[model samples]
Target: MPRFAANLSMLYPQHDFLDRFAAAAADGFEAVEYLFPYDYSTQELRARLSDNGLVQALFNAPPGDWAAGERGIASLPGREAEFRDGIHQALEYAAVLGNDRIHVMAGLLPDEALRGKHQAVYQENLAFAAAEAAKAGITVLIEPINTRDMPGFFLNRQDQAHAIREAVGASNLKVQFDFYHCQIVEGDVSTTLRRDFANVGHIQIASVPERHEPNLGELNYANLFNLIDSLGYSGWVGCEYRPKGDTHEGLAWLRQWKAQQA
Candidate 1:
């Protein structure tokens, strides 16, 4: 069975951020992930993880000015320095939290005409991040987000993400395959997973269209989970979805999956 990591950023919205760690643990999640850990001291965050016996499965590198609506600066031409600084900061936090993987968000591209410029900057920035992370024994992940949810997200397709990873040629650089996004951008999720399985570094899931519990969506997560096991994927599968009702109440799918596995 694939290990599931509760995405605290989306799950358990009822509790304070710090409190969510324990809530996830009590609900049977062995690991947790969130959007940004920069706001809290590493000691505070680490303590929460240790106290709850939850592993820090993943977290994103700082995206520039999230409050100002800048998702990420990695692919932006003039923000290379800021992007690099963010990568360093993320690495520092990862070390303290004992996380081995970090996701790099590719910022929005408002103008399609400037895609060439953005792609060049993105490739260079990723290469730099991968090299730095490699020295720390960490894997750098790039995810292809759906344009509908993130209208101007630079990376939106599985093939595009893998191509950029190949072009960058960093052995430690890999793709963060999110099934929710993949289903939105391209319908053939299973085939894409199999085709890109080797290059994948991480996995995430949510219901399609509504972005709720995996079992509520158009996709058959049970079969997909089985397929993932068959493919020999031994990585954390992030439950990156918003709950339709009470978070704990919405965890029936998880309990069912675990029971089926047993």
Candidate 2:
């Protein structure tokens, strides 16, 4: 069976950020992830994980000026220094948290006409981040986000992420496969996983169209989980969804899914 991680940022909005750690543990999640951990001290975050017996699975590097609508600095031509600084911060946190992977978000292109230039910058930034992370035994992940959720997200397709990873040539560089996004951008989740499973660093899931619990979606997560196991994927599958109701109440799928896996 695949190990699961609750996305604290999206999963436990009912509780304060720091308190979500215990809530996830109480509900049976052995691992957890979130958007960014910069707001909290590493010591405090580490204490929460230790107290809850939870493993820090993954987190994204700093996305510049989140309130200013800048999703990430990476891939932005003039923000290379800021991007690198964010990478260093991410690595520092991961080291303290014992996390093994970090997603490098490619910032949105200011204009479609700048695709070529932005692509080059993204590749370079990923290469730099991957190489730096490799020294610490950490994998750097790139995810393909659907434009509907993030309208101008620079990386919007599985092929695009794969190509960038290939061009970067960093052994530790890998794709963060999110089924919800894939279903929106490209419908062949299983086929794509089969072909690129070796290069995948992490996987995430949420219901498509509505982005809710897996049981409420068009995708058959039960089968998909089985396929992932059959494909020999041992990485964490993050529950990156917004609950339609109480977060704990919405976890029936996870509970039932675990029963089925058993």
Clash count list over all predictions: 0, 0
Q: Cα deviation in Å at residue 253, candidate 1? A: 0.7
**Candidate 2: lDDT over CA atoms?**
0.94
Residue-level lDDT tens digits of model 2 in 29-90? 99999999999999999999999999999999999999999988788998999899999999
Q: Which window of 10 residues has the lowest lDDT sum in candidate 2?
A: 253-262
Per-candidate Cα lDDT values, in order, are 0.95, 0.94
| Model 1 / residue 14 / CA error / Å | 0.6
